[model samples]
Target: MPPPSDGTRHLAPAKVNLTLHVTGRRADGRHDLDSLVAFADLGDVLHVSPGDALTIDGPFANGVPVDDRNLIRRALAAAGTTRAVDLDKRLPHPAGLGGGSSDAAAALRAVGADLGLDALMALGADLPVCLAAAPSRMRGAGERVDPVALPRLHAVLVNPGVAVPTGAVFAALEGHGPPMPDVLPAGDPLDWLGGMRNDLQAPATGVASVIADVLAALTAAGARLSRMSGSGATCFGLFPDPAAAEAAARRLDYPGWWARACTLNPSAP
Candidate 1:
C-alpha cells in the first residue's frame, strides 16, 4: 500500500474480547492469553499528514501522554515518516482491548509509514494481529496469527469508563498458561473458536473486577459468548446479528460507560 494522501487517513475499528483466559505463564513472566480478538465497527480515528511533528486530540485525551512511549511516536520513528501525525482518540487506552495497538496499526498502515507487519510481529505478538485487522486466530504470546474464514458474528463492546493495566494483570498471573492449538479447523473458524478460550480472564478478572461485571452484563444482555478482551476491563459478547448486539448494548447502557456495536469484520470489520 502507498502512503496516505497529503491531508487525511483512516483506521479500521476495534473491539474487546468476548472471552479471555490465561491458560499459563511465560518465562518472561508474560501470560499466554488465548483471547477471541475482534474489531468494532467504530473506533478511534486518526488523520495523518506528513510533517515534522505529532499531535493528538479528542475525548479521553486527559491522560494519554505525548512521548516516546506513545506508540504513534514510536511507529513514526520506526517508519521514518516524520511529519505531522494527528490522532483523535475515540477508544480508551488500557481497557483490555488493544485500542492503542489497534490505533498504532491503523496509523502504521495509514501511510505505509511504520515498519511493516512482518517487522512488527518481531516487536510484539499482538502487533501482527493488529496489522491483519481481521477476525482470526491469535495465539502463542501474540507472535502467531493465521487468517481463517470466520462466521459472521456481531457483538457489543462495553467498558465501564475505567482502564485496566495490562502489565499489572500479567504480573498477577501465576503461570505461562497454555500452548496454542496445534491446528484449527479449516472452515468457519468462529465455530471452532467456540471450543477455544482465552486463558487470561481469571487472573485478569482478579485484578480488575469490572471485567467480571462487564461479562455479566453481556451475558445478561443475551450474548452467546461473553469474555474480557486482552487483559482488560472491556468485555464483549457475541450475538447473531447487528440488531441483537445493538439491542444488548441498549439494555446494558451506562451514561459514562464506553460502548459500541461491532460486527466481527472477517476482514477488518
Candidate 2:
C-alpha cells in the first residue's frame, strides 16, 4: 500500500562512524575510505506533503541552505518528484555527524521513488548508508553498505560549534593509514572500538583544535571510549549505559558547545 495521501514523515537519524580508515586516494582525486557506521536516535525530522516546495525550520535551520544547493533538494531531484518537505533541522551542520546526508537520505526514502544506486551516490557518499539506517560496514568511498547487527550503545555526541569543511580535512591529512581488519575483532564492542581509530582525527584536529578538547571532556566525564567521528568537528563518547550517558551529558556545561545523549541502533521493529 502507498503512504497516506497527505504524505509520510521520516526521521533523519545522526550517522556516526565508530571507526574510519582512509585506505587511499583514487585517480579521480576522490579518497577511498572504510568506516564502521552506526546511527543515533538524535537527528532532524522531515515531513513530506503532496506538493513541490521545501520549508526548513528548527534550532539549526539557519545553518543550512534552503535552495537547490541543499542536499534535501538535491535528493528530491534525484527521486524525480516534488514534494512539500518540511525539515526540522536539529543537528549541527558539518559536525561530522552526517546530518545533511542523513536528511537527504530520509527525504529520498520518503519520496517512495526508485532512484538507482548510481543516482544515490551522486547525492553524497554517505547517503546510501543513511538510507539503510542501520549498523553497517561502509567501504569504497561509501558505495558499499553491508548491514551488521551491532549491539545497542549509549553515547554522548559533542560538537564544538565549528564547521570543518570535508575538503579541508582531507587536504590536511598527511597520508593514508593502514586499513582496519576486514572483520573487527570479536570481543566487547567498546574494547574493539578503542583499538581502532579515525585516521582523519589528527588532520581534522589541525583544522579544528576544539575536537581534541571535546574528546578530553568526554573522557573526564567517564566515557569508556571517546573519539572523533569521521572527518570531525564532532566526537562521541561511548558509555556503559543510557543512564550514565545522560548523566555525563548533563554534567557538561561548556558554553557554545552542543552535547546530547542518545542511543545507537534505535530502529523500531
Candidate 3:
C-alpha cells in the first residue's frame, strides 16, 4: 500500500566525523573506530506521499540507484513497510558525508521503525548515529553511540568532485591511531577537536590528491581549522560563526566542486 498523501517531509542531515581515530582491527577484518560525530543542518530531503514508485530528483541525484539497492528501499524493507519516497539528494555520495546512510535512517524515521541500535547497525555502521541525528561519541566498529553535548559549529563543507573508495582508503592505511581522551575537555569543543584527528584523512588524500587541495583551500580561506570528514573527498572548514563560514564557502570557487556553509547541531525547529 502506498503511504497517505499527507506529504510528510523529513530531512536527512549529512553526518560529519569531526575527529575519527582508527583504534584496531577486529579478528573479522572490521576496523574499530573512536570518533566524534555531528550532523550538518543542510542535507538530502525526503517527501513521503501517495505513489507507487520511488523518485529521486536533486542537483546531486544523478547516478543514485532507484532500485532495491537503494538504502531507503532497503530500510523500508527492514521495517516491514513500504512508501513512495521522493528523495532530494542534495549531498554527494562517497564523499565521506554518510549521505546514503542518513537517507536510510530518515526513511526508517518516516515510517516510525522501532528497530534497536543493534538492528540499525546491521543496516549500516552509520545508521545508528544518523538516526540519532545529534552530536555523539561513536566507538567500536561504529556500533557504539553515546549522545553528547556540543556547541553549535559553523563550517564549510567541500567536495572536490572526486569519489574516494572506502575500501581503497582502508587498504592504504598504515596503522591505527590512539583514541580520544577518556574525558572530553570542557568549554569550546573546537579547542579539543584540534588536538584529535581523522586517521583516514591521509590515506583518503593519497587515494585522491584533490582532497589535499580541498583542505588547503579551506585553510587558506581563513578557517580556524580544516580537516577531512569520514573517509575522503569531502572536507570541512570550521569558522567562528555563520558569517565566517558563509564567506569562506564563497571564497572556495573551485570549478565542479560542491561547497556549502552549514551549522552542525543546529537548534531544533
Candidate with maximal lDDT = 3
lDDT of each: 0.69, 0.87, 0.88
Q: In terms of lDDT, which candidate is stronger, 1 or 2? A: 2
Which segments of candidate 1 are over 4 A away from where they belong? 1-7, 15-26, 31-36, 114-124, 180-192, 266-269
lDDT for each residue of candidate 3 in 121-194, tens digit (9 for 90 to 100): 77889988888888899999888999887888899999999988899999999988888897887877778888
Q: After superposition, how far is residue 211 of candidate 2 from its true place, in Å?
A: 0.8
What are the TM-scores, per candidate, against the unseen true structure?
A: 0.84, 0.95, 0.95
Query: Candidate 3: worst 10 consecutive residues by lDDT?
Result: 1-10
Candidate 1 vs candidate 2: the TM-score winner is: 2
Candidate 2 C-alpha error for residue 97, in Å: 0.9
Ordering by TM-score: 3, 2, 1
Off by over 4 Å in 2: 1-7, 267-269
Q: Please, what are the lDDT tens digits per residue for candidate 2 over residues 113-187?
A: 677879889988998898888899998889998988688899999999999988899998888877778776666
Error of 1 at 108 (Å): 1.6
Q: What TM-score would candidate 1 get against the native?
A: 0.84
Indicate whether candidate 1 or candidate 3 has the larger lDDT.
3
